[model samples]
Target: MKQGIHPDYHPVVFMDTTTGFKFLSGSTKSSQETVEWEDGNSYPLIRMEITSDSHPFYTGRQKFTQADGRVDRFNKKYGFTNKD
Candidate 1:
């Protein structure tokens, strides 16, 4: 590990804008905003548009489309059967 060459890694808060969910994590990114965490310590605040808390997939609001495969659809359309 080289010294003075690595980016500064520090604790920061990531907040989901939509859900207002916040979590503490380490990041090299910096911001002018600051927040006091539950641990009674202040860390840099980073605002995010989306996170696991508000994401459709993570929130169980994601839609799964079961589309037929191209080959299967083509075979079915032409009435083709596998000989093997």
Candidate 2:
């Protein structure tokens, strides 16, 4: 642990731009914007385009494409039928 060698880790508010969700977390990143947290304290506000709150995967809103196996695709493409 060298002095003045590590970046400052402090509490910051991460905001999800899409959902307007905010959460307090420690980060090395800094921002000029600030926000008042629920704890009656002000912290740096970091705006994010996507977070767990709004991400499709995390929210279970992700759309999955139907996929066919290689064999099935080949058979469908060439009009091949299984003999067995």
Candidate 3:
């Protein structure tokens, strides 16, 4: 451990924009944006698109992807008929 060679580890907040949720954690990252936490202290706020709170997979909210169109397109390109 070298002195003055490591990044400053400080308490930070991660804010989920999609869910409007926030959690306090520690990191070496800093930000110009600040928010008042429930503890009554202001900390740097980091906004993220995906978090465990709002992620579809973790939340058990699955989204369906249409593969039928792609299969049809591939079959049409190769002149394969859906005879079945």
Instruction: Identify the candidate with maximal TM-score.
Output: 2
lDDT string for model 3 (1-84, tens) is 789999999999999998899999999999999999999999999999989997887999854343577888899999999687
lDDT of each: 0.88, 0.90, 0.90
Q: What's the C-alpha lDDT at position 79 in model 1?
A: 98
lDDT (10s digit) by residue, model 2, range 1-84 = 789999999999999987899999999999999999999999999999989997778998853432346668889899999799
| Global lDDT of model 1 | 0.88
From the highest TM-score down, the ranking of the candidates is 2, 3, 1
TM-score of each candidate structure, all chains considered together: 0.69, 0.71, 0.70
Looking at model 2, which ten-residue stretch has the lowest summed lDDT? 62-71
Model 2 gets an lDDT of 0.90
Please give the range of 10 consecutive residues that has the lowest summed lDDT in model 1.
62-71
Which digits, one per residue and each the tens of the lDDT, describe model 1 over residues 1-84?
Answer: 888999999999999987799999999999999999999999999999989997778888853332346668888999998999
Query: Roughly what TM-score does model 3 have, to 2 decimal places?
Result: 0.70
Model 2: residues with Cα > 4 Å off, grouped in runs: 63-84
